[model samples]
Target: MKIALIAHDKKKQDIVNFTIAYTEILKQHTLFATGTTGKRISDATGLEIHRFQSGPLGGDQQIGARIADNEMDLVIFFRDPLTAQPHEPDISALMRLSDVYQIPLVTNLGGAEVMIRALDAGFFDWRKLQD
Candidate 1:
């Protein structure tokens, strides 16, 4: 499965921690992430991730494109709700695309844990039927 790992500025460290904790499960699949977040995750966990531009610079849109093209399956985005993002519209669009395409999206650490567990259990095989 192709998984996207995204995190807002304040949540970047949290995502890196999550990646470190779940390295074994995560390293089993292809990973993609926005610039700084990707760098931090890769550096911390040594997982190979395809990195795109920074979120405010179109990274979200790039991942959204993969989602739209049926090239993406899961999205783990650690959003900082208290902070305001300059690229809010792009974030909204990316989320909307996830919904439109029926992709599994986890917006917080709790949800990401559940989704990652499900992934480990092979529950996402249902996604193949959608394709």
Candidate 2:
């Protein structure tokens, strides 16, 4: 499975911790992330991640492109809803594309935990049919 990891500034630590906790399962799959988030996770968990530009600089769009192409399977985005984001439109578009493509996307830590577990349990095997 191809998983995309993304997080807002305030939620970076939380996502990093999540990645650390799930490193074993995560390491078995291909990972992609935005610039800073990818660096932080790679540094903390030693997981290899394909990094794209920072979100505000076009990372969201890059990931969205993959979703549109049906190249991405799961998206774990730790969004900081309480804060105002400068690139709100891009973020919205990313989420919208996830929905449009029927990709599994989780926005909070709890949901992410469940999704990661599901991934480990082979719940995402259905994604292979789309290919």
Best by TM-score: 1
Against the true structure, candidate 2 reaches a TM-score of: 0.96
Lowest lDDT block of 10, candidate 2: 122-131
Please list the C-alpha lDDT of all candidates, in the order they appear. 0.96, 0.96
**Tens-digit per-residue lDDT, 1-131, candidate 1:** 89999999999999999999999999999999999999999999999999999999999999999999999989999999999999999999999999999998999999999998888998866576766
Q: How many residue pairs clash in each candidate?
A: 0, 0
Off by over 4 Å in 1: 129-131
Shift of residue 97 alpha carbon in model 1, Å? 0.3
Tell me the alpha-carbon RMSD of every candidate.
1.0, 1.3
C-alpha displacement of 19 in model 1, angstroms?
0.4
In model 2, which runs have C-alpha deviations exceeding 4 angstroms? 128-131
In candidate 1, how many Å is residue 60 off?
Answer: 0.2
Error of 2 at 28 (Å): 0.3
**Per-prediction TM-score:** 0.97, 0.96
Kindly report which residue pairs in candidate 1 clash with one another. none
User: Alpha-carbon error at 31 in model 1, in Å?
Assistant: 0.3
